[model samples]
Target: MAGTIDPDAGISAAGEPITEAEALQRLRQSEDQSQQYYAAWWLGRNRSRHPEALPLLLATLRQRRPRDPGAGVEENAIARNAARALGKLGDAGAIPELLAALDDEDDGLREAAARSLGELQATEAVAVLLRRLASGPAGAGAPRLDSPRLQEPCEAMLEALGAIGIAEPGVITLIEPFTAHDRPLIRSAACRALLQLSGEARWAEPLMQLLDHPQLQVRRAALMDLGAVGWRPALEPICHTLAENSLKLIALRGLVEQGAHHDATIQAGAVLSAMDSLL
Candidate 1:
């Protein structure tokens, strides 16, 4: 008997049952806005298999046709999604286009570009991203949101630098000042980035103190970053935080993530008792 090939073998790794050539062609020629958007998005999501998607994505992003006055926000969605896709692709080849995108008029697009540069670990982009950071937080007066992830572009830039984790000679100096930024979220991101870059013993004490920041989001970010850095010296402060209902989940999660699980059940009971004593 002859060997049989699976009919679905043609599908790309991104789960689309189509050829890369076809997807790229559709992204270029499809007249339906929705189809074009999905095709561009697909190219990025499946970019590892289709390294050729970079040029097409860049071209799609460069197309800046003037929109009718009433087109509303959807007018920018295509380019924005393309920028996002480029970032997720993590190709250094896309760095030039992604750099250009950092100055894009749209806030969302600029953020997407900044985020992608970080994903690519584009060290050359550090200067530009830092410039954006220096430009200051865009949401200084905006209404408060519930999560640090909802931070403005400035905060996003700081977080990106942290994600890149490059310990350039001047990097710490630049980021350290932000630790005292007027905005608590920026302060939190700065602290997180600083820890990520150096993990110096000196940071342990200050990070422990920030656990008491007025904003819950700031405290949560501090806990998450502390755990990620595996700072075991923080076990005591983390245990104390577990007594507060609001901080308990993140504190416990941090402790487990840092491998402080010895007698965890007993420690958890002690934490709960501490909570009751405060009642």
Candidate 2:
């Protein structure tokens, strides 16, 4: 019953065949009051099975204006819904349009576009989103700390990139520059991206270097990422640094948690005994 098409709702009416033209026309003519709302709802609800509807949904996304009391026109729910539907479709074709929408002046629309891009796993959108994160208020450090306008989309993009996996050459190259970015957030993002791109122990060195970063958060994140790589040797330097800094608790914890001991002297004695008990 979940997958059944609802005829009364103007969707797959009569269980009859629908052409692309008909679908597009339905989307276009539904511009008035009631019809527009229904169309938006339908598009958002049925985005996946109806790939043909993508173009229409994209077109509507571009023209629909958000509801503002001052603007007079009823808020275009259909357009908003269509945008969401296109995102749910997860079709790669929608990436370009979604990227264009990233620059939308309307915060809500830009956010929806960003969400759609993430849903689609639009790798091409990665570079654009990263650039935005690196340059937007969050990356650039604006005074408005509480603004969701900057943080929401940037965070979404970061999660999306992480989900998409960083195996692509382009993705790796795009993320590389951010490693040296002035902002720790950007550098951390790059580190995470690298972890996703290549799980190789080679990344351990660079990530380990960040343990000495001025930002404590950066150090912690690097430590976590290093553990993720699970390279036994990589944990040695980290443990030494932690111990030398009087961060013995954290160093001991890292060793215990990872079942890794870098120092031969320490590994041969009670340290191993302590580690075995913890395990």
Best by TM-score: 1
Tell me the lDDT of model 2 at 240. 48
Candidate 1 backbone collisions, by pair: none
Candidate 2, 19-78: lDDT as tens digits:
445455667775354554455456555554564577767777777664575875545445
lDDT of 1 by residue, 106-144 (tens): 655777777677767788888887675553433331334
lDDT of each: 0.63, 0.55
TM-score of each: 0.62, 0.47
TM-score of 1: 0.62
| Model 1: residue 70 alpha-carbon error in angstroms | 5.3
